[model samples]
Target: MSLSFELTQSIAIIGGGPGGYEAALAAAQLGAEVTLVERAGVGGAAVISDVVPSKSLIATADAAVAIAEATDLGVQFFARGGDGRPLRPQVAINLAAVNKRLLALAHQQSEDMRAALVAAGVRIIDGHGRLEGDHAVVVSTGPGGTDFDRIEADTLVVSVGASPRELPAARPDGERILTWTQLYDMRALPEHLIVVGSGVTGAEFAGAYMNLGAKVTLVSSRERVLPGEDPDAATVLEGVFTRGGMTVLSRSRAEKVERSGDGVTVTLADGRTVEGSHCLLAVGSIPNTRGIGLEEAGVQMTDSGHIRVNRVARTSVPNIYAAGDCTTFVPLASVASMQGRTAVFHALGDEVMPLDRLRITANIFTAPEIATVGWQEKDVTDGVADGIVHKLPLAVNARAKMMGVRDGFVKLIARRGSGTVIGGVIVAPRASELIYPIAIAVDRRLTVDQVSRVFAVYPSLTSSVADAARAMHNVGRVAEA
Candidate 1:
């Protein structure tokens, strides 16, 4: 089906991540000529160096962990030892093959995104796009390089995304001290990986490497791992990581990282040092807001250098908008895409949905993923919400039991008076997929009773969600009685 629009304005989108690409498609589909400027491939850092590649690597690591657990399910392996002793079970990984597969998947995603954009009639300019004026941009090949050309647009969409934050004292060499983006280039697993930071990215890499047969040490400046996540879920993950042979150092800040011959040493702020074969710095990301002429064009930015945009993704300047990690909103691919689409919709005079942070669902892709949507339990505990919390453990679920999942649970928060489901948390395998139902409920403002009435498949992991909803209903009844 072809979409028709009466507007004849052209839009320029800088960056090619989910936000930039999705906005480009939306604008083009709405009959606006779109030009997408990208320094890298079509899918930006999320597809090329970060999300897709990291997740693909995790997929192989997950398979290895599954094989290790197969013995418990009566799957035995026999291996003849070189020393004449029979080895009952052994698990091995070809790091080269795994890296190849990971890169292959990342490339496939990039190609798919390119094809989609091309088919949608969005012109992709291979260069760094910077705003030359309030209504124009110059695409450059490199820093201080020749200006390829300039394009003027009626509207501009800034989705410049972000880069790994590097400390001056702990600069990554991409060998011993590495950034998260550099991990994809490694063909061999580290003997021991020391991951600095306990945020989502740091915890995920630390967990993935540990599962892939590498001893992992996670250093956190906070009191606990995943300090920003739900406290209960964080506690559960911390326990799981410890049981999985991960050394988690809390309240430790990495002040410096330096190469020590073949290995690396990370110094803590408290005069302690940890040595490992490799060090992965996952401190955070810095928004790609510099040298974009944002200040000259009146685009307001936060103190941290993230672009400040309104609910419709509009910058302080009327004709300019921003989205993705470059904005002050949560750095999530899903949220970025929504912000991009919303920007395009508003620019084209279409119906625009205001950004709703409460409806956004986010996941930390650990061994047992932690997915959360809507309000958090801490909000209720802190009297930030007029709600009650209900939790159901996966150990009580039939499917979880069959799948040998002893850890993990689903927790739901509902409004005390209306029983309206406000938020939920799922800590289990494939929690990313399982959180969608809760996301939909939160987005549509569905009640707990409405969620409980839905017929979830019997003996499925999702039954835990339904059970949690049902528990909420029962608790409501007890409160009224």
Candidate 2:
């Protein structure tokens, strides 16, 4: 069925992240005249600075680790030096080349987005778009220059995204003190890297750099690293990081950072200081909600500065909508895209599904990716679930054993009385891909028995998921009197 919207009304989208661009495309496809305004390149942080570049670097690091593991598969190596030390794994990274590839991929993605929008008849404007008044926008072009223009639209979608939060006392100079966004600019590898923040971004970068052959120290203010992630998953990752030579300093909050001659020093809250070749501040992200006329337009904002939006992405102001990292929703590319599409659908007076936080799936791309969907154990403890929990260790899986994976597991949670799968977690290689079936099951409200009946390969990694489901099959039986 062809979906149609009012052809006369014009739609304007601010920001060019997955949320913004995907909404623009959907709006245009729905037959609305759309104009997309972006200050940075089209692909946003995911394609340009943060996700893509970091994963590419991780790919290189993974390759090096793989070569080191080849000896277990009976690959013999010879020493190339006079000292007879097996050539030291001989992997050299050209930072310039890596950066070049990253930019090229980003540009290609941007171009593809632009071409798709142009082909769909969506107008593209390169500028910083800010609301001037109701249904009006002032676009500042050419970064920091006085090129300004005004445009009018019937509906507006705000998805200005986010920036890395900085410490007031330890502002990044973009040199010795750097944010995760600035890491792509470094041409030489740091001899030692001190990462401040134990969140997903911090943990990912810390593991990536450590695998890339840099001495890494992860400083966390929380009791454990990745405090927000699954407890079991976090425990396993902490052990892996420790085994891989990463110094994890829990309960250590970085109070200040200072540069001293070719290196940097991080002072902890307790007055202890650690020196390193570089410091990466992955503290958190601040939504780009300021100077966007949200408050002037009567849109409510949270105490934490995120735009207050409903499930359908509507703000306090009727005509103004918000999505992506600019709102209180979890910051993820997939969720952002869904929010953007939902915003457009609602704005155009079409049938729309409200944002389902429980259905959203997220993955942390560490050595063995951690993927989860639905309820959390902590949430369950807080009365969020009256579900039975089942866990299957990867060490028992035939594929994992053959692949030499000793650490990781699959966990599923189902309602105690109904046996309906409400949550799942996977920690293993390619866990990101393996989580999709579980996500679909959760989204569709499938029972553990229903999921277990589905066929799985005999000796595959996905068998762990099946095992977890089978383990949950007895939940209802045990719950009954």
Best by lDDT: 1
For residues 1-481, write the lDDT of model 1, one tens digit per residue. Answer: 3456575789999999999999998998889999999998988999998999898878888889889988777877788899987788767878888878888888899999999999999988889889987899889975576757788999999999999999999999988889998987777889999999999999999999999999999999999999999998999999989999999999999999999999999999999999999999998999999998999998989899999999999999999999899999889999899999999999888888899999999999998999999999989989998788988888999998888887899999998878888999999999999999999999999988899999999999998888899877765665577
Q: Candidate 2 residues 1-481, lDDT tens each? A: 3675445678888888898998999898888888899888787877788777788787777776777777776775666788765574466667667777876777788789888889999888898889976697788986584898788989888998989999998889998899988988888788999999999999999998888788999999999999999999999999999999999999999999999899999999999999999999999999988888888878889987899889998888888888889898878988889989999888887788899899999999898889999997777778878988888999999989888887899999898889998999999988899999999999999999999999999999998888889877778889995
Query: Listing every candidate in turn, what is its Cα RMSD in Å to the true structure after a full C-alpha superposition?
Result: 1.9, 1.9
For model 1, the stretches where C-alpha displacement exceeds 4 angstroms are 1-7, 80-86, 142-144, 475-481
What's the distance in Å from true for residue 66, model 1? 0.6
Q: Quantify all predictions' global Cα lDDT against the true fold.
A: 0.91, 0.88
CA deviation > 4 Å runs, candidate 2:
5-7, 79-89
Give the per-residue Cα lDDT of candidate 2 at 35.
89
- The deviation in Å at residue 304 for candidate 2 is 2.9
Quality of model 2 by C-alpha lDDT: 0.88
Residue pairs with clashing backbones, model 2: none
